[model samples]
Target: MAVLGCYINMVHPVQAERRKALDRFKEQIRYARDFGCGIIGTETGNVHAEIIYTEENFKEQPYLDVVESVRELVTEAEKFGVIVGIEGGVNHPIHSPIVMKRLLDCVDSNNLQVIFDPVNYLTPENYMNQDVIIKQAFELFGDRIVILHAKDFVIENNEKKEVPVGKGLLNYNAVLPFIKTNKPYINILLEETKEPDIIDSIAFLKRIYYQTV
Candidate 1:
């Protein structure tokens, strides 16, 4: 289950650049099988072309822009028999579980699915409440989830900071049990990890992933 990381800013502020980005994404879709990959994964992007955090991303227009962008990508993916895996984050337009659910509904294409990253959703203010948020995500779109991005985060100076899977505060217990039960053998791609940490992260995930329910 190889997934090509074709990450790009789908909602680029400039129309010309946005079209070019989409064209490049479609090209990846066309050549996905050549790389022995059936899924092309990306984060639903920010309104800023620079990919920085902005309050504008939370507005309606950016959300609609992401919907249109994903629809276009899904159309190209459908032709190539590839899956378009969209990921959401705090900085992007499709920022929350409810927003992601709406995007999934509006796109309404079988080719469009999710690459869920639980750590990406955590904020300093909401980190303590992640159990509820993660559970809501599974309840809302567990069936649509195609991949999982594993990482951990900690709060430093009242801001969220990313770290390797087992080195920080992300509760894999909230995630792995659901994967074991519903999405057996699903790919859990690790991010924000380094050498010694990567090995420990994989071992950590395997331990929880194989735990009895």
Candidate 2:
């Protein structure tokens, strides 16, 4: 099981709180091997004290803050041979494929990698272009991605509202084919999907995965 150190806000606007979060994340990195997991996953978070959506997170300093925090985590992870798998979202600093690519370039460490969740990257404004976005992510950092989060979403009131996998707008065809070609056997974690739905989601993914050839 991978360590889900996903709550720490890597770009907290407060310096002290940010440091504390980093320390806790480092602690997780140090002990991940004991848990038989090599990778610890997290999101490049928002700038505000509260983890809410804000346009300010799309600015330069929050992105820089994430870079700094990730670099530190990567350094600590390298010593323990743990990988830091960072996920991006529309609401956070590393908000898209391009920004995620920039952070990867800036960190420049093999210990630093991606936990790609296509639904997390989707916004109402961009969900319609998901095929393009998914293609961009694979083209940019498919090799860097160590985990995939499987979920789906529906558009409601012009917002992207998440639902169980295989019950919404995500195109597994766009995702699983790439996984089959370039990332076979990679771990796919189900996000916010439960019981009976989980079984169906698995069946849905397997059907496409086997047909991708």
Candidate 3:
């Protein structure tokens, strides 16, 4: 079995408590290296608020905090020769392709990378134009994407809900080709799947994979 990466959970926002989180992240990096995996993944912890990213909450302070924290984590990850993959989303501090690019530029480490999940970056305003968002993600960070997550989302009752792959509105038709042409060997992980649903999700992704080729 291929273990592309291991995830590190978010830590508490308190400044004093960040040490423990960094220790755990370092441990995960070590574990990934020992297991022969090249990547370790995580979301930026909710440092400023529970739901970290919002129009009002999106500011320079929080972004700098995340960038500083990741800079330290990348230092540790470099020791293990493991890439640190930050998962971006609308809820996290690194919310968009522009922000992600900024973080990468700030960190300026090859060991730092991205775990691309297109659905996680969507909002109500941009969900309908997801093809453009997906394209932008690949265009901006394609070289840094270590893994791609396969999932779907829908706007139900004016709330966006994640569903099984191919069940929701994600356009695998666009996503698949981008991955095939740019990062053919990147791992595609199926998220939100149960034991019974795994088979169908795998089948759906495989069909898309072949069709994209």
Candidate 4:
């Protein structure tokens, strides 16, 4: 039980009721705070299934809806003195670095921060430019990152699939330095890995992490 933070499923179907979602999130905040956890993490809602990244979808009302919902969640988080971490991805409303920054600025709360997962932002077209994307994410949300998600992505059948930290396309050589330099005390949570591979993933991450720093 090394984990001192809890990741809340804020994108469930029941979250469609925005008020209920906010209430549930606030309750989770209290639960985390009472249990000695300092952070409560969640992702923005899902994107349009048919067209994930479209100009119209980005400008749609749903995006603004998520923003407003997060703003309310952050306000509640402030009262509990627990951090509300938002994990953004290409399939969610806070998709890009720009949108992430915008949300941070809009929320304007010290308790509101990011749970960064680089693999979530990677797309087939931007896979080659991963260095740029990773750098931009650190630069834009560096001060706002409270937790880091350790995972990797692979292209199978022309679709992205999550894999263990070192088993896929993520370049830890580049990512580790950014984390070490900018959020040195941040917690790195492993995801998308089998239980048997957790130890190996942690060892691999620690090896690169120490080597980078």
Model 2 lDDT at residue 58: 93
Model 2 steric clash total: 0
By lDDT, rank the candidates, best first: 1, 2, 3, 4
lDDT of 4 by residue, 68-155 (tens): 7787888878888888888888777778888899889888889888888888889987888888998898888888888888898899
**Candidate 2 lowest-lDDT run of ten:** 2-11
Clashing pairs in 2: none
Candidate 1: tens digits of C-alpha lDDT, residues 72-149: 999989999999999998999989999999999999999999999998788999999999999999998999999999
Candidate 2 ranges beyond 4 A from true positions: none
Off by over 4 Å in 3: 1-12, 48-57
Which pairs clash inside model 4?
Answer: none
Per-candidate TM equals 0.98, 0.97, 0.91, 0.87
**TM-score, prediction 1:** 0.98
Error of 4 at 19 (Å): 2.3
The residue-by-residue lDDT of candidate 3 on 52-166, one tens digit each, is 4455325677788788779888998888888888988887667788889899999999999988999988887789889888888888888999889898888988888888887
Once model 1 is optimally superposed onto the true structure by TM-score, how far is the C-alpha of residue 89 displaced, in angstroms? 0.6
lDDT of 3 at 20: 73
Model 1 backbone overlap count: 0
Off by over 4 Å in 4: 1-16, 47-57
**lDDT score for candidate 4 against the true structure:** 0.77
